[model samples]
Target: MNENEAGERQIDIMVCGAGYVGLATAVAIKQARPSLDVVLADAAPDGVWKKDGRASAIAAAACAMLQRLGVWDELEEGAQPITEMIVTDSRASDPIRPVYLTFSGEVEPGQPFAHMLMNRDLNGALRRRCDELGIEIHQGTPIAGLDRSGACAVATAKDNRRFSARLVIAADGARSRLRDWAGIRTVSWQYGQSGIVCTVAHERPHNGRAEEHFLPAGPFATLPLPGNRSSIVWTERTADAERLVNSDPFLFETELETRFGRHLGAITVESKPRAWPLGLTLARAFVTHRLALAGDAAHGIHPIAGQGLNMGFKDVAALAEVIVEADRLGLDFGQEDVLEDYQRWRRFDTVRMGATTDILNRLFSNDIAPIRLIRDIGLGIVDRMPGLKRDFIAQAAGKGGPMPRLLRGEAI
Candidate 1:
């Protein structure tokens, strides 16, 4: 580590975001290359992650990466495996929403394709592993400015403390200031829809089954959780979603019940419903100079496929692998040429997923008779093809492309 004349603290790497991707990246790299110094700085206050009641779908490959990072054991107990998934398309008022497609089976012999895990639990687990790896975490310290014109990138924190590192990573969020500061452009647009998220308790078991109902407004997904509770991602027009979430308790439950159905039995809202606007935000470039963007900083897509977080995990895996390998070869991993490998490996997949979710959202979130008929037929055909279903399950499990060491359950 080297310090400049201005008293800037220097480290090998500086990760600007304490979200899962940032935490996982720090842990993955530090665990593999202990000699390298790594630090994480977040804008949020300490313990703020505990209040996130939201949960995410962790694909099989992401699960393996977390396990390799020594964080999964802490999260495994609370995680709920998704044994089956069924998709249906119909109006909200439909009495019988027929299942047009169903997916089941495992990528491996015993491991299911995906699992549901609370965001807080996953973040806590990753944070704990970071502590074990001796990574310094600075909370409430946001990046105020970034200067990459020198030999090393200097990140100025909100508190005026400067951190000089060989490489700076931005994993902040979709609207990333670090990404902008680095002069990285993005292609983005709002979907005019918002996803209303909440947890619901039911009288009967969900049997580890996940359901995605394609209503006129958008997809309503109920992902199974521990016990008789399930997590809901109900999409609707922005105005309608805002009104529903802010409306009275009785009204929210009544509206939620209409789409949630009776299969799970008498359902009760267990958490405060929150609505998040849906959109697609993809960075034009994942890296520039000595800076690299990860997680939402790189791309944000619709939750129609439940691959948002999984895609971020893919960024963590690929970035960590590239950085670690480059360091092993005694090369400056922060160089643009080195970072380009990461961008190349991820850009196509990110764009593909973004385009796919966009098409699905547009194709399903409507009442057009001709489009509905065509989509239903497509779903029916896919349902009948066992080979095609297996391929989809594998893709959803994060097994579509070249496997990274961490994602394949191997140490970097």
Candidate 2:
């Protein structure tokens, strides 16, 4: 409506792809700086996601991030806690090694490691917060074009609408078109495996225990959900995964049971099985002139560690804090000084997590005799060493890290 603002220069921040990171980033920034305008656009309908088909394991760290965003207090009782984790090398008929890790603590005096939440439920909660914060959302609109200069970045959506901003973050996803438009090259590779994710209802309760059964082909995991249901992440060879996903429910569940064993007792397919291709992707650089990459736009890693989403959340937290600080300091949020700081803060952590997950996948995705012996002993050693176990537990709880204030459940 104002020609001077658009024609001369404006400093609005546009977040493309209002999925997890996009929405999270938008709301985080709004909460941090109420005066700054944070806009999000996506190519889907805007709605509350109470019961979406997919579920993601939200780590304690991620939960803390949400709490800081003022979204956690609203999540329903659907967020299930994982009181225990059981890992086993499923090479032989019996477990070559079985390791159990337990944890019970709170963030303040009533917080607990993490919770199992439906993707929709979490998104729904964020959406409500966005509503309360007056965050602008442009849905059913995909960015179709872009124009950038030293002072401003412009985006053209599918609706033929033009939006301009001082900073534009690409949270679009692995096949991020925005990253491509920015001429940012990425290193990407397939894991030669695929993870089949689904929720199953079992005869016996999982007792809040999550299980990861590493076999020769790949890793199969069962994370506890509400009731007697468990979320399964079964990794398989690419070709086999395609076949299994295409197979009927009965056959698919049969194959799943074969690999899962009877640990959870008479398991029944409760939700439709889904297939996610395993892969690794790292953007050559995280920022361009006035643009920055967030979430999958920056990196994509194997979900074996359940750190993929958590990593994206970290990027969101860091980038939001950095930009908000720059605004308060009256500095150009997209200037090299700000962008460089973000790259430095995120690059190391992103690279380490990617490498760590890759190595873990390779090491445990097999049944090699030597590796089996070594890892089994390693597990037993950690099990016996309570101090070491506590460290591991804390790490898994997302306690020990370069945490932002929001991640620490503090107001930003």
Candidate 3:
């Protein structure tokens, strides 16, 4: 990076939002094309990332990308592979919730489809890799405004720091200020529900199995973590979710136990329960002029399929590949034409996943007998179809469609 006479920092690319997608994008590009100057600026205060206690399921393809970037080695010790998964649809009060679908096996020999790792661990590993690559991260440096009329997009920070770059990538999350400043509109809606996230320790081992119980409110997922701990994503109506998270400890645990079941033996809450409103936000246009959107800035889907983070990783992989390849060919990587390739590659898959999740959440988050019976029958049919199950596993593993080089475990 260089500074002009006006003291404005100039670079090849400026990535807003230092979360997983932004960090990975910077790392992947710099690792492949070291000549390009890349830097990250986040609105969050320094060290705030260390406080996130939530965990995410990293798909096989995402793991491959992280390994390629040389960050997975640091996270492997704490990662817990999800070897099996079962799905059931029933009311929370049902004494016996019959399993409607089951999924097992790996995408490749000995490689589970996904693994769970705490958000902090993932963020720390990526930040370390960024450090090793000489990438500068400016915490608490929120982009106050963006000017895209000039040859380079100039971002003005809240503190009046100016950053000029040929391309500006917004991974600033669902409610991205940069996205709006760029005049990008979004198609979105709320599900009238909020997801309650927390960690719990169980007396018995999970044996690497994950479970998703579709209750009247929404899907309650128990994702395995290292040892006898598991991360929970329980959805409830907005008011009830707010009450549950702020309720007394005893009351909260009692409500949690009602849906957690006895299969895991007694359970103890290990973290404070937090609630996040569930919604879908898809940007109307992913790229315009010198600016582009990635990760949650591009699309935010329901977490019913556990593919939220994985989708962001896919965006990083695709965007990085497109930028790297364009640069390799001696072309302007920030040109709208070049960025359109990325939009074309990711838009369909993203829309499909969004629609699928929306439909699933709507179909299962109810107790209507007819809808319940139809979905149960569909799940049962899917369970019995080996080929279909394999296809679903492949998709979840992030290996179904034409994969980007990084996702395929190859160098850009």
Candidate 4:
């Protein structure tokens, strides 16, 4: 550890952003090598992230990683497993929406392929683990910029506090200041669509099923939560999204029920509706010198595939393995060659997932007659092939191909 002229603190590793990815990276590294110094810094004040009402689908591979990190058990009580997935294509007002493809959401006999996890619960559990692991956490300390000229990367907080570390992980989200400081370019574009997020309570139970109804505007996904509640990710044009989000409660609920079938019965909003503009953001490179990008800072894809966080978790796993093994072999963990290994390990998979989501969003978020006919036929064909469906379920679960040891629930 080193100190500046002002005597600010320095550490071996600094993780910028206490969100799931940042926390996971810190905890995974600390657990694998307990003696290494790790610090987590976030832009938000303490307890501010609890206000995030959104939830994400945790893939089976991510569940395994969390379990290995000693956080999943704390989240199990609030986590809702998705037992099945159904996809359909039709207009929002269509009386009959035909089911296209169906997937049984199970990786094994008793293990679910994924779970709908409230963001607060996930972050809370991770914070507790960080506390137990003795990983230093600095709330309200956003990385305003980064300097990588010396052996250690220096991070300057918005408050002007300086933290120098052998390596810096930028989990600072989609618009990353550290990424820009590192001179890493990105490939990005807006979809002109926004996702409306909210939680809803209904009279009938959802039976652990998830549905994706492809409307002309975009896909409307209803993911089952515990009890009679479900989380909705409703996509629409930006203007329509704003109108629905700001609509009166009665008007909003009426519109929601139109797309959400009557099977749930008497649905009411359990949380305030919020809209997020949709887009695709992929960093041109994952690493530069001693700095590395993870999670949203590295890639942000459409929510249509629900793989955004999973991809981040994959980064956490791969980066942790690379660093831990390199240290075990007495190599410079922050050197360009070592960091390049991580870049090569994750860049290809990230690009592939981003492309897949972009294509799916374009294909489903349209109403061209011939295009619809062809897509429906493709969906039907896939639905008929049980073997193909199994492969897709595994793919979505993040269980296919070569994975980092942590994702396989093994220690680094």
Which should have the higher lDDT, number 1 or number 4?
A: 1
Model 2: per-residue Cα lDDT over 323-350, one tens digit each: 8888889989977667888898889889
* Candidate 3 residue lDDT tens string, 182-298: 889999999999999999999999999999999999999999999999999999999999999999999999999999998889999999999999999999999988988999999
Stretches of candidate 2 above 4 Å error? 1-11, 47-51, 92-97, 100-110
Q: Report the candidate with higher TM-score, 2 versus 3.
A: 3
**TM agreement with the true structure for every prediction:** 0.99, 0.93, 0.98, 0.98
Assess the local accuracy of residue 145 in candidate 4 as a C-alpha lDDT between 0 and 100: 74
Alpha-carbon RMSD, each predicted model? 0.9, 2.3, 1.0, 1.2
For candidate 3, what is the TM-score? 0.98
Model 2 global lDDT (CA atoms, 0 to 1):
0.80
Clashes of each: 0, 1, 0, 0
Candidate 2 TM-score over all chains jointly: 0.93
CA lDDT of each candidate? 0.93, 0.80, 0.93, 0.92
Clashes in model 1: which pairs? none
lDDT of 1: 0.93
Clashing pairs in 2: 106-111
Residue-level error in angstroms, candidate 3, position 231? 0.1
